[model samples]
Target: MMKIIYTLFSCLIFTSCFNIERNCNDYKTGTFQFNYMEDGVEKTGKFVRTEAYSIDYFEGKIDSSSVRWINDCEFILTNLHPKSNQEKRSIHMKIISTSKNSYTFEYKYAVKEGNRPDRVVKGIAKKIE
Candidate 1:
């Protein structure tokens, strides 16, 4: 039992030392591209972000959203001109890890209603400019 406990403790220590790199500041204000699946088809979208707003171009449709940063790695996006009740909802996004030109992120609806489960989706965005 002692040997088993020692091995488990050592494994936990080593794994805890491994950390994911998050250089979210480098991607705060830039043009980025990401892919998403729509009706079983893969589609790519691009967006331009500044300090206060983000403009997205997808399938010839343009959308603008307000950007509110919670911290260096987290932000909330609210549509500036929501077309429907669903669009009025805000999204919460977090930067999990980053590479040289891309960052992995997870996003979900910012607010939840009673009896509704949370659904988070992860994606990678590559900086273009």
Candidate 2:
């Protein structure tokens, strides 16, 4: 029993020491491609981001957003021209992890609406240029 406990403790210690690499600065301003599901279809979208702005091309529509960096790994994105009530809400995004040419992110509404629960979505984006 003591040997088993020691082995389990050693495993836990090693696992807890593992960390995900994140180099957010490399992705701060670049062109990126993301693949996601929309209406039962998998689609790819591209976006170009500068320090303070981002332009997204999706579904043949070009939309722009203003970006405010909260930190090196997080930012708030507000649509420049919202067409609907849902679009008016700003999104808060954080870089969860990153690899050599890609990063994983999680995003959700920046401001909660009434009693509605906030929904967070995660995706991976690859830097294209």
Candidate 3:
């Protein structure tokens, strides 16, 4: 019947979505820049990870902040002096596309405001050697 057809159709879509290959270890090493949009302005920054466990994320002209990763794709960005909401921005970066010399990543910036949800940013980073 129609009901049987609808149920089977929905299951096909759901299963396909869950099958994408997601291994974070292969996608995590590089120097990346944030071409993220904040308050309708494009903000730029550089993130340098000497290895998998250590990184220095820098913004503006010359000031840089060091951060550490929990794993290949997840890391905590922190600031020492602590000013504005930038100090506590919870960032999660996931790889979407990869090639010989670059990768496209999708990221979400968690918000603390009660009325709004997290903001998502996506960009491609070229590998630096």
Best by TM-score: 1
For model 2 the TM-score comes to: 0.89
Query: Tens digit of lDDT per residue, candidate 2, span 18-126?
Result: 8788899999999999999989999999999999999999999999999999999999999999999999999999999999999999999999998989899999999
Q: Encode model 1's per-residue lDDT on 1-129: one tens digit a residue.
A: 999999999999999898788899999999999999999999999999998999999999999999999999999999999999999999999999999999999999999967889899999999999
* Distance from true location, Cα of 118 in model 1, Å: 0.6
Q: What is the lDDT of candidate 3?
A: 0.61
Span of 10 residues, lowest total lDDT, candidate 2: 13-22
Better of 2 and 3 by lDDT: 2
Q: Enumerate residue pairs that collide in model 3.
A: none
Q: Top lDDT: which candidate number?
A: 2
Q: For residues 61-91, what per-residue lDDT tens digits would candidate 3 score against the true structure?
A: 4434445566666655454444676655655
Provide TM-scores for the models: 0.91, 0.89, 0.55
Per-candidate clashes come to 0, 0, 0
Query: Which candidate do you rate higher for lDDT, 1 or 2?
Result: 2
Where is the poorest 10-residue window by lDDT in model 1? Answer: 14-23
